[model samples]
Structures are given as C-alpha cells and as structure tokens.
Target: MNALLDLDQLRTFIAIAETGSFTKAAEQVNKTQSAVSMQMRRLEERVGQTIFVRDGRQSRVTDTGLRLLDYARRMLSLNAETIAAFSSDAMSGKVRLGLPDDYAPRLLPTVLASFATTHPNIEIEVVCEQSSCIHRRIQDGRLDLGIVTHGNRTQERNGRIIRSEPLLWVSSAHHSVHCQATIPLALGTKTCTWRAAATEALSKAGKKYRIAYVSSSAAAHTGAVMAGLAISVLPESALTSDMRVLGEREGFPEMKHCDIALLRSENARDRIHNALAAHIVNALDNVSGGAALAAE
Candidate 1:
C-alpha cells in the first residue's frame, strides 16, 4: 500500500482548493489540466480517499482534502524554514531583485549598496514594480528575490520578511483628512497596500473620497499627495523626504507594516538567497548608519 502522500500532489490539491477550479490550479502549478488531474488521481489512489468532489462547472474539496491542505501548507512552510536554517553557507550569484517604488527610493538603495560593497563578486539586477507584481513574479520563479509590502501580514506567499515599517496617512503641506463635502484621494493601482487601506478607512469612517490621482508607482502616489491632489496612506519609510503631516487622527486602523521580504523559490535554503537574506537583514538593521551614509 502506497501510504506516503506525495508532496507535489498535495500542493496541487491546495492550489485547487484555493482557486476552486482545476483550470486555475493547472495554470498556477504550471502543468497542463490533464497532467494536474492525473496527479490528483494518483494522490487520491495513494491516500485511498476521495479528496475532491468534482462537478462539470466546479470542484470542491472533501473533508479529507481540506484536512490535507492544512498539513500541506505547514509542510511547505517548515520545508522553507528548514532550508533557510541550514543553507547559510554558499557563494552569492547574480541576484535578481524586485522592489516597490517607495522602497526602492527609501531603504533599498542602502541595502543594495551595502550588499554590493560587502560582496563585490555578486552582480545585482534590480526592478522597481508595485508590491503586487513583485509577489506574482516571485511565485512564478521569474525572479530570485523580492521586497514587497505585507498589507495583511500575508505570509501565505513564500516570503521571508526582513524589515517592517508602519503605514500612515499623509497629505500636503497644511491639509489633513477631513470629512468635508468630498475628501480628495491619492492612490496607487488597485493592488497597493496603502491605497486600499486609506479608502477603506474613509468608507468605514462614513466619509466620502474621490481618487484625485492614481498611479501604478508608489512614488507617484506619494507625489500626488505632496502635490496636494489628495490624501494618501503610506509607510513612514516612504516619507523619507521632508513633508508636513495632515489630518492624522490617531487610532485609525494600523495598516500592516510594509514588509521587505526575500521572496524566493521554495529553495529558501538556496545558498544565494540565504546570503542575500542575511546581508539584507543586517543592512536594514543598521538603518541609521546606512541612512547617514546615503546622505553623504
């Protein structure tokens, strides 16, 4: 009796459970629909349980499949921690990194420059994109590592956080958020952490706001607010520049701190990622020293 549940098959089942459709899961796992179905079948045979109840339009996990998914997530998470723990020694390589616009301008330069100065042998490739895009790329294995904002303390994705920064609402020189006839809003794309929080807070507070400006880049989002187009919420780190605070009412929901994480492949134990992660954590920890040096 084949009793050991296959890890790959379990992962596929988890994806299907999350998506609730085999087509979506197939795309997510980078397998053909038929291949994905075959893997699930084999997994069911090995476990001797019907994991999914499939209909023509949709599929849902049986109680057994749901139970298996919880274990699968833990297995993958532990599998990551195990790698990061042991694979602390290796040569750094061409490290491709993705960062959000605000982070790229604020903390990332110091982090990268320090890493470069320390390990001159490893070449660094950097891309500045929205945090949402960064997470997607990391999951797709298109990049080696990434730094993204954790809007919800989102650990579901395979990312290991290195630094966390608070998110706050900010506006132009003398303006604060007010429940006037209309509150002006400055926002990033739909995927941005700050944008969503700012809007949601307004709605929950029973205030009205119109997006005066929306940009894909966080820098542009902040820039719009600085230009007095509207109010916006952002990580304090994004306020690296001199700007006056406006209507910051205390006790507004604290947006999950912007988390700069090392979003790598399942191979968190991979030598290059481990080295880069260490270098990043160390550099971010020395925030004052690096900021001062960056000033020079």
Candidate 2:
C-alpha cells in the first residue's frame, strides 16, 4: 500500500470538507472549480476511497472522508510544526488578521500588546469587518486568522471556540428608553445572528419593539444606545460605564449567550500565525476588564 499522500490535495480536501461546498473550497484555495474537482479525484484515487458523494448539487463527505479529516489535520499541523522547528531564521513574517469592528477597541490592544512583546519582528496586519465578512476573508485566504462570533456550532466549519459570554440587553445609563411602550431597538443587520436572537427573544416574551437603528459598526450601536435612542444587544466585553443592563426584572427577556471563536485559514501554517492565535485565545480566555455587569 502506497502511504504517500500529497499535502496539497490533502489541504484542498480539508478545505472542501470544512466548507461543505466545492465552489467555496476552490475560492479558499485560490483554484479553479475544475481544478478543485480534479484534485479531489486524484486524492480519491490515491486513497482508493470515495470521499464525497453528490447530494442535490451539493458535495457531502462520506464516512471515509469524515474519518480522514482527523488524520489530515494532524498531518498538516505536524508538517508545519516540523518545518518551523528546524528553520534557522527566527520567526519573522507578516500575518493578516481580521475581526469585527466591535472587538477592536477592547480586544485589539490586549491581544497585540502581548503578542508584540515577544514577536516584535513579525508584522501584524489587521482588518476590521463584520464577523461574517471576517469569516469569508479567512475562507478566501485573505486572512491568516480571525476572531468572529460563532453563531451555530454545527454551521461553524473551521474555527475554535475561544470565549463565551452572555449577550446582554443594554440601554443608556441615564435614559428611559427601555421604558417606552414599544421598545425601540438598535441592532446589527438582518443577517446577523445576534439580531435574529434579539428579535426572537422579544417575540417569545410578548414584548413590542421596533428597529430604530441598524448598523454593523459597534460605534454606531453604542451611539444609538448612549443617546437613549434605543436598547441594544452587546457582548459582556463591549459594555461601557454609560450603558445599563436590562433584564427580566426590567421587562426585557433574557438574550442568548454569544461565543467568540478563532478561525484559522489553511495558509496559516507558520509559527508566527500559530503564536498569534495562541495569544488571542489566551487573552480572551482570561479577559477581566469590562463593565462589571455580573450580578453578585
């Protein structure tokens, strides 16, 4: 039995399995769709196993493919670690990172400060966008890694859960916005999971509400909340002194918890990338400096 596996094909195979779409996998690997198909065929031939099956124009991974996923990830991780271990030159390269705008003010400084302390030579390029946009960039290989809101565990194909925090309903500290008959709300766009959760919670609680403002920017959400225009949903970290938490006692329903995840691209195979990922995970896991909203 030939034990040799082409790492490139394995990488593409991992991409396909993770993304659940050949078209998306192709985009992530920067390959033509045909090229992606050809690579998968070759990979199947090499393994002598059927890895995927067509399901109504969609590619579904076979049992063998699911089994291979673990091996593939281990192989790639070991390969990258081996290369970095023996490399003579110290780690120094540019790593692209993406995250939602809301996280930058609180998350960026802490993460960058710690990482930079040890890896000053490596350049970190940051891009702030919506969590969905950041996820896409990581998939498309435009980013080395990203911090994103992990909505559904089953739907999040390629990311590690880093932090979990309660999603709180908040309004201006000095305002009576939450007292309105029809509770005015500021929230993310329609596609945002947070927005969906917020609306769903309101409906289930039999509360009347109206979307008074919609924006992807955290600053915009904060602005709406601060000016007493509307109540908004925010992660525990993003809370500020000027915001007051709303809960069942205040006639607001309990919101779902928000999870923060670290998503890495297939291109993130170097020590620098790994280092940054580790730092981010560590920083977030131990984070403590937000408005102390936890009830005693």
Best by lDDT: 2
**How far off is residue 216 in model 2, in Å?**
0.8
Encode model 1's per-residue lDDT on 62-154: one tens digit a residue: 788778767876675555445545665525568778877777775665567545534545677888887778777777877777777665645
The candidate maximizing TM-score is: 2
* Candidate 2 Cα errors over 4 Å, as ranges: 1-89, 153-155, 290-296
Residue 25's lDDT in candidate 2: 62
In candidate 1 the C-alpha lDDT for residue 115 amounts to 55
Give me the displacement of residue 156 in model 2, in angstroms: 1.6
Return the clash pairs for model 2, or none: none
